[model samples]
Target: MANPIKIIGASLSQNVRKPLAVAHHLGLDVESVMAAPGDDTIKAANPSGRIPAMDDNGFHLSESVAIMIYLAGKAGNALYPEDVQTRALVNQWLFWDVAHWTPAYQPIQFERAIKPMLDMGDPDETVVAAALAKFEREATLLNAALDGKDWLGGGEPTLADFAAGAGLTYAAPMELPLDDYPNIKAWNGRVMGLEGFKKTAQGQ
Candidate 1:
């Protein structure tokens, strides 16, 4: 018997959800470890002090984005496409979220929402507002890309949607209106309605 790919992370974290969702889409059997705050297990596995570290057949890997791409390539077509251009498009959005959206928006969302809940003081209003403003701008760019299409790269939901949606889930509590971006709204709804999406969202 092989050591199943062990996904260690807090289920509620968006970064962790990316690979988990991909696993569900690919129907792969994986062992999930719900690493919690103050838990030393994850810190030991990932020196960066992050969740979403994995042990794939003894090959230790960290970082959510890297895990996703590795799993997709291993799972093949279910999540990763064979077409070079399509694969490039998926990678493009995945990179965009990491380099642009996640870096810009997640800190504000965490500080504003999660921190206060954990008894941490409220985040600076100006900073949150500025981040949200920037988020809205990039969201508008996404809306434009979604114009008349069902998904980011076209009809079928690709890894791009998963990557982007995982990052965007931070907005779930904000209840922002999708009316301004009908296509995006539809896409989000579609992604969220997947088999394990609700389960994953609920920290399954």
Candidate 2:
């Protein structure tokens, strides 16, 4: 049997949870190490000092989205898919999460959650309001995308679900108002119901 892949990052992190959920869903053996971004452990594997780096049998890799795709591909899972068109669709949501969804939601998360937790003073309501505005715009797009579909890529949950869903890991804590986006709320429930997500949630 192959050695367990080392997944380096705190389990609670949304980025870390991305690959961890993929690993679990793909039935890949993985060992989670709790390290935060900028830590020396993470620095060795990712020059950018990012969390959620990977050491698969000594092959180091960075970036959460890349790690999730690699794990799914390595396991020959349907989550990553093989068809070009299907893969392209999945990639679209993955990239969207990194480029759009995350950017919109992260500021709200940092301000409402991370700031207070780290004794960084109270949240700047101005920052929160601006982020919420951006998040609402993005959520409208996502809600529309999920209007008739259960999953982003197709019928079965794919990397798209995992990648995009991670952005809402702190939705409640951050007080994200999801009531306005019923489609997203329903889809989120489905995504959270997956065994991989359930397993990862236990650690968090």
Candidate 3:
């Protein structure tokens, strides 16, 4: 196994869950060093002071997807896959998660769930409404893509699934409109059912 690595992030964070879930999927049982948002320690790990940075002994890696890819590679699993074409497709979805999918849900999560918990403020109805509209569009595309497939982009679950599906962690709390996207709803259940996902979901 690779030298025991330490994940720095809260358990509830969607990005933080990726490496933990990947470790669990690979049977690594890795430990994490909890660092919540706005923690100064996060700056040393990620210049942006983001959660989900990783320390592999002395080696450091920021970005959840990058850490996930490294963990998957270490595990010798095909979660990211090897075929050039397949890999490209997997990467495409990963990019989409970070760019399109994540952004769409972020406002909702912050405005609806997180803000209130942190005593930030009430959710902005205008933001929620706009996000909901955008979410519906993306969710529809994702739903159609997932049709008749057990996982995203076909075959077994990949980083794309984790990257995108993690947002659903806040789906209910943020009141994300999933009613119109049955395929996405069902796929999310399958992703959540994985033993690795279950084992690594709660942060210490």
Write down the TM-score of every candidate: 0.89, 0.95, 0.93
- Error of model 2, residue 107, in angstroms: 0.4
Q: Write the per-residue lDDT of candidate 2 for residues 1-204, one digit (tens) a residue.
A: 678999998776888989998898888888898898899998888888888899898799999999998898785678988999999999999999999999999999999878887899988999999999999999999999998999998789999999999888888879999999999999999988888888889444
Model 3 lDDT-worst window of ten = 195-204
Cα error, residue 68 of model 1, in Å, equals: 0.7
Q: Which candidate is the best by lDDT?
A: 2
* Order of quality (lDDT): 2, 3, 1
TM-score leader: 2
lDDT of 1: 0.76
lDDT of each: 0.76, 0.89, 0.84
Q: After superposition, how far is residue 171 of candidate 2 from its true place, in Å?
A: 0.5
Candidate 3 global lDDT: 0.84
Q: Per-residue lDDT tens digits of candidate 3, residues 20-134?
A: 8888878875777789875876767777888888887777889999999998888677788899988899999999988888888888988988898789978899999998887
Q: Candidate 1 at 69: error in angstroms?
A: 1.1
Off-target runs (Cα >4 Å) in candidate 1 are: 36-39, 175-177
Name the candidate, 1 or 3, with the larger lDDT value.
3
